[model samples]
Target: MEIIEWWPKIDPTAKEWLVTHNGEAVAPDVLTKIVAAGGSLTSDAWWIGEEGPDGFYLSDEAIDWIEATANGEKA
Candidate 1:
């Protein structure tokens, strides 16, 4: 899956959130968690992937975490 980091300051709603990353929809619980986090987040980057569509990104540390997870390294 591709990871997309959302710009928390500029985004405040689920539709806005989805449009920013070009996504269809996400669970309310997930969106709640994302909004609950403060701005300029340094971790908990959003993970994304689509069929023949877009790529994604995450925080530097989050990227490391993703790599480790994909590589099967325990946290």
Candidate 2:
């Protein structure tokens, strides 16, 4: 699955969380659904970084696929 394919499967609050904390470490469960839907940590969409004692952190691509989708672009 691609980034576009996984975006909609993500929860609304999860989307907000990613936007609000674009480069921060998040709870594993925070991205559970996303990963399950085939969101990639190594793809242009995001990357898995140092694992904190708390959990893992992720940084996504510069292009905001979520916003693009919201703006009526083809995902």
* Number of the top lDDT candidate: 2
lDDT of each: 0.40, 0.63
lDDT string, candidate 1, 1-75, tens digits: 123333333245643444444333344444455545442334433442222333233344544544554455873
Q: Write down the RMSD of all candidates, one decimal each.
A: 10.7, 4.0
Which digits, one per residue and each the tens of the lDDT, describe model 2 over residues 1-75? 565577678888877776666666765676787787777765554444556776666534423554455567764
Clashing pairs in 2: none
Candidate 1, which segments miss by more than 4 Å at Cα? 1-56
TM per candidate comes to 0.27, 0.54
How accurate locally is residue 34 in candidate 1, as Cα lDDT from 0 to 100?
A: 51
List where candidate 2 sits over 4 angstroms from the true fold.
40-54, 59-75
Q: How close to the true structure is residue 6 of candidate 1, measured as C-alpha lDDT?
A: 36
Error of 2 at 67 (Å): 7.2
